[model samples]
Target: MSSRQRRNDSAPQYLDATTLTAWRNVRDAGEVVVSRISAEMENQSGLSLDWYGILLHIYEGGEDGRLPQRELERHLYLSQSGISRMVSKMQEAGLLRREPSPHDRRNVYVVLTDLGRDVFLRATPVHHAAVQRHFGSWLSDDEIASIGRGLQKVLTAEGGSEIQCGEELDRLVTFGQSVLALTSDTVAVSDAILVRDALEPLLLADAARHVTPSAVQDMRAIVARMSTLIDSPEEFFRSDWELHRLLAGYCHNELLRSMYLTLLGTLSSRLDSVVPTTNLTPYLYERLSVHARLVEAVSSGDEDQVAEAAHAHHFTMARTRLVDAPGE
Candidate 1:
């Protein structure tokens, strides 16, 4: 039999064993929960899961809340025109507006509005329920904490990049050459799918924001959900990537997904001067705190507070990182 057939045949035999079976059940249960929550979110809030994610980012960015399309593209791994189109659509919907960036004429800023905020405020509860119904119900405090530590260990072993564009990438490459410095444990080729899964929605939402805040938020929610997969890097990456690609495929724009994968692939392979040394346990603790805060903010309908806390939480992961490269 071929390698593919061999792997598949081996998978069932192994998966049937007790340890692997339990692990598979946990993963499958989470997936079911998410599906139920997504459906509920759609029915009650009239917002898809992806839009919820974008709203969180905007909420995090705060009042006077805005980010340049290019910046969004870089931070979120979105393409140029993709973000532009998204902005236009959202502007028409009155959820977000576009203005020329003061710092650069070539750049455009995407800003949320009162209407957008109101929608987010109302949807918070429904979304929270979905989260609880899914992952929260299955996980205890200690188990969740353990998962966080495990994920952090993986991140340390697989340090990622700042995820910039062509121009920024060139600048960093040149700087590294000049300093004779490079990050150890740079993102490797094998991790491309994970990186791609991380970037896809951020880019699409950046583009969609121009069209509709709800759509942009939906994309963001998808990004957030994808990011939560610290379960099995290899399996989760493969499973999630296929799922999103399949969903994006329905739009008849394979390029949307393909481009995201390509960008992530590049990011997975690129290196800067420093490798991540973040401890998984501490990082997870921080993330758990953030999740608790998110639960509270969503319940209270305090979008601004939620946004601020989320940004702060993501930043703390750097505390455990190795400031200098691994070998030196």
Candidate 2:
């Protein structure tokens, strides 16, 4: 090949040194700010960062300062059981209370008590101060504007919008439950099967869309990273979530993508809980192969082929988790 032809055929390098440095700086700065703020929040208010976040979300959640239990779970970086326990503890402390949904007996809502509101009001200043000290202080006004513009561009590209209400909201809640069932070990096999069945069609539809080349490349990189982490279950699980996030990004439906992002916290918590004890090597390899097929199907833009690949992927995942469960 001619030298120019060889260069044209090579993969494009998206991240130059300056871009890499900026990305690392943002990541490190975020970690530092979070650490400082968490320590201050705990020391001054006796509230862990997670507790404070839950309280804050509850306070802003709705007109009545109440959020449904499942919605609350979405806002929280906790598993279903972990959030339940946290709610119980907060209730015992007179911070919050849970009420059964008036319309649906099976549903529960979390309401911030007067005391919870007061606590949140008190903690807001401390949180702001930490952010100012560790994060805001370091950035110039121009830099802040640039960062906001950059983030807005990202959000726009990702189909970001305010969470929709009504029927879409209901569907989102159901999606969250399905995700919990798929990730949590405590869910009954019957329930898991039901969740998988419900999710399969959605995944197939998402797979049928023609995703941007950047997304395809992102999945490829995630799969490569997963291969390197096969022996490190925790890291592998983290990479697994990244892969799902990329796949979810391919959904052409804005509401579906938004809902998927909302449930990521719960998904992360559930995956974290299961990774340590589960035999993950077999599952990892299976996932890598399935994802490879999925990428190919997506690239071809064949709806039937995409659906077939998605079905096989979900079946393999369910079998890996249910049939080959830890200690079984």
Q: Point to the candidate with the largest TM-score.
A: 2
TM-scores for all predictions: 0.38, 0.42
Model 2 scores a C-alpha lDDT of 0.62
RMSD of each: 25.9, 23.9
Which runs in model 1 stand beyond 4 Å of their true positions? 1-34, 74-78, 152-328
lDDT of 1 by residue, 77-135 (tens): 56777767665665665666778888899877778776555455445545654675577
Every candidate's lDDT: 0.47, 0.62
Each candidate structure's count of clashing pairs? 33, 0
Residue range 1-328, candidate 2, lDDT tens digits: 8654565467773455776798898789879888998887666556767777788777666559788888777655468899898888888777789898998898798998876765665455455556667777789999987987876665666665343223211111111112111243322323333454456558547745758777778778887887788677557667866776777767777776665555554445544222122223565667667777877777677888888777766641322111111122
Worst 10 residues of 2 by lDDT: 168-177
Model 1, CA-based lDDT: 0.47
